[model samples]
Target: MSIQKPGYKSLYLYLSLSMAPLFLAFTPLQPAYAEEIKNGKQVYEIGCAGCHASGVLDAPKFGNNADWLKREQQGFETLVKHALNGFNNMPAKGGNPAYKNEEIIATVAYMLSEAGFPNYADRTGVKAVTTASTPKPAEKPATVAPKSKPATATKSYKNTNQFNRLMAPSSEWNPPQSKDGIHDPENDGTEMLQKPRVAFEPLANSTSGNRVDWVKALHNGEINPRYDRVNPDAMPVVMDLNIVREVKGSMPNVVYPHKQHTEWLDCSNCHPAIFIPQKGANQISMASILLGQKCGVCHGKVAFPVSECRKCHSQAKTAKK
Candidate 1:
């Protein structure tokens, strides 16, 4: 025999025997890397944490197996459908419109896993099977009944509170009269003539003074009145002095609505000339407008007749105590 120094077959057998245990140790760990619950934690943190974290607005708290189990009994598919479509206070996709359906399912799985239900996939799979078994029949659309001809009653529908207030003929329908020569029937209302002119005087005086014509004070930049330009598009139609009297003892600066006047005029009608772009510039006085400076510019002439004292100074007509 030619002294073979350890043949190749013997070397191969020895190497295989040495590494067998190492291979056995890592084989069980392969599935862990293959199927990881991905982006589930991120989705939960951004979307579910808000209501679920604290049980806000009566939402179910996170990690509470009892709460989640109760919801689970409704079936995972039903719950998922609710989450996708929104149920009551819980907005759809938890109010994140951009979340994909796969992302939603993954997030639901993660939440279920965290709530001690690690076998979420098996449970959801069973739920899907059961849902598929009880197939619902397709619904037929409801047939619309033919519309009947409208009733010929002369009386209007009286269902609404608004109709109660407005539809009835006025017990007193007095036509408005003019001192000069301009009257519109559309403008013939107590609010247009009386309420607007009267209610806002005290609020005007709180900022300026009694002698100052309230309308002139607003136009001349004596009082910096703020208004709501938002919904219903509020303007200072008339300022109620009672509002001034209500808060005047505690807070000295409250202006009333000269709101109604602006309904007839444009923004440029009073801006720049009446109010400075830089706040707190105009200093107004009653004597100034009476001499035709600030409010006197229009109040006694084109806007309304300011000669009537009771118009602005009328006290709240108290019931005889």
Candidate 2:
């Protein structure tokens, strides 16, 4: 009907043309934001929030930069794989089977964001930065920052050859780095991977102070030289024996006799230093022991060769059954 012009129609046409610039301005930003994933946060809240939020089972706290900084050095990919496969007490997908891989990746990104790497995935391209430059959180660990050096740019995590994975750094910052932002783990002026493998000299002494040695000496009315020095009168010292029950292993269980050790060395030697003296407190892995920690301190160095497995594992095979 070609009658009088409708005011509302003119108004609608005028508004649409005037607002065209506004639509154009937001068009480019869509992809930038659309690519940035927040799905990880959603999944984390539903699946991982309970444990990670509060650090249950020593789970890295969500926003605790100090807690996640060292772990983040291992690379985002490694973290995702650990989540997919399951790490220690955490089940795969945080025990939620419904989560997808993308969700897990997003969850990891969310964790990194809270740890100080805001927009971690987009900035790092889901890869570790090729620098020792660590991101610092607004709030930091309660302890004082390293007085020796500050975070630098340029470090590599390519080696991935850490022998011990269970133990993470706590309350110490050694600054395992050089001025150029290089981390030579050996500290011997060589690259991480270029460093020579750990070497051990041939067994210097086959005798690892076995039970048999102690028994034979006692039967013949002789005592260990170290003990002999302590007790010249041949009087036995009163011992508060603590029998260590070894968990299942490749060899027979070991029955650690505290009485035997105390006879030669004082309580100070092992208490709170080499051994924590608490049940299950010591994560004594054979790998670390061979590297000269725990019993390896004296066992292989001076006392005896670790080759003498039967020395500590005194229980007969038949008895274990």
Candidate 3:
């Protein structure tokens, strides 16, 4: 007999390793019911309070039976469906998708019970109970007198010439530059600063009417007007200087930034002249611009294109003559 020894060390190590997982599996997990309800309440206050509290847009008011009863008539399942899909003004899931369907149901149930609906019950299985008791008032604290410290002396300055100094004119005062560049004693820096500050005046009455650049607008898919011909290589050059001058009237001729336009748009965007393609062509007019046609095609539609007189005409008002 070779000492008839039992080989238990290796077996013990193997059994210990196997039991580790079993021990972990049986460990008790703490309940999360209280924490879940706390979180649910916070979520409800932020997302549901807006419409539910005020009954906005026919929303069921919080703690109100009449409104909830009307909604419940449709049945609980239908109500949950409505909450998920959203009805009329109520955005789907109250516009917040982070809420779990279970949480929504639980919160709705809580709200129903709070509103005096007897049928509502806590799905979490927790019940709250109250006990009545007499309350006592808080006792007041005793008062004590405060000790006073000796006052310290402060230095004072006096000048006999104070009145004369007040009457004297300020030495920093300077005369203002007149309209002619010559300095005038009558008008001073005070008058210069008092003048109103210059402000930006938009070309049009409302920026809403202003149009975007044509090519840029087309490139942005803003305008989809028909084009007579599609020329990839062709750019939006000034078709004629004379036409621009006539259309602009008394205002400075807008140096149509054609290169800037072509960069963003295709020829088809403004081709056939913002009108149907006819060889001799259709007449583009100021009336059309106001109506959002031709130049109005994009001025207000997508590009800074408009026939509003003030937009272009008023530029001279702020310009240095």
Off by over 4 Å in 2: 1-215, 223-242, 316-321
lDDT tens digits, residue span 153-229, model 3: 01001221235422222321121233212333245663464321121121112223222233445555555544335
Q: List, residue by residue over 25-139, the lDDT tens digit for candidate 2.
A: 5533231122222255555666788789999988999899999998899877677667765667666667543343444555777789878987574432232222212322112
Q: What does candidate 3 score on TM?
A: 0.30
List model 1 lDDT by residue over 38-153, tens digit each: 24455577677878888896676778888788887876666665665567676655655334333345456667777878876432222322222211110100111111111111
Whose lDDT is greatest here?
2
Q: Is candidate 1 or candidate 2 better by lDDT?
A: 2
Off by over 4 Å in 3: 1-40, 118-121, 124-321
Per-candidate Cα lDDT values, in order, are: 0.46, 0.53, 0.44
Q: How far is candidate 3 from the true structure (C-alpha RMSD, Å)?
A: 33.9
lDDT of 1 at 170: 33
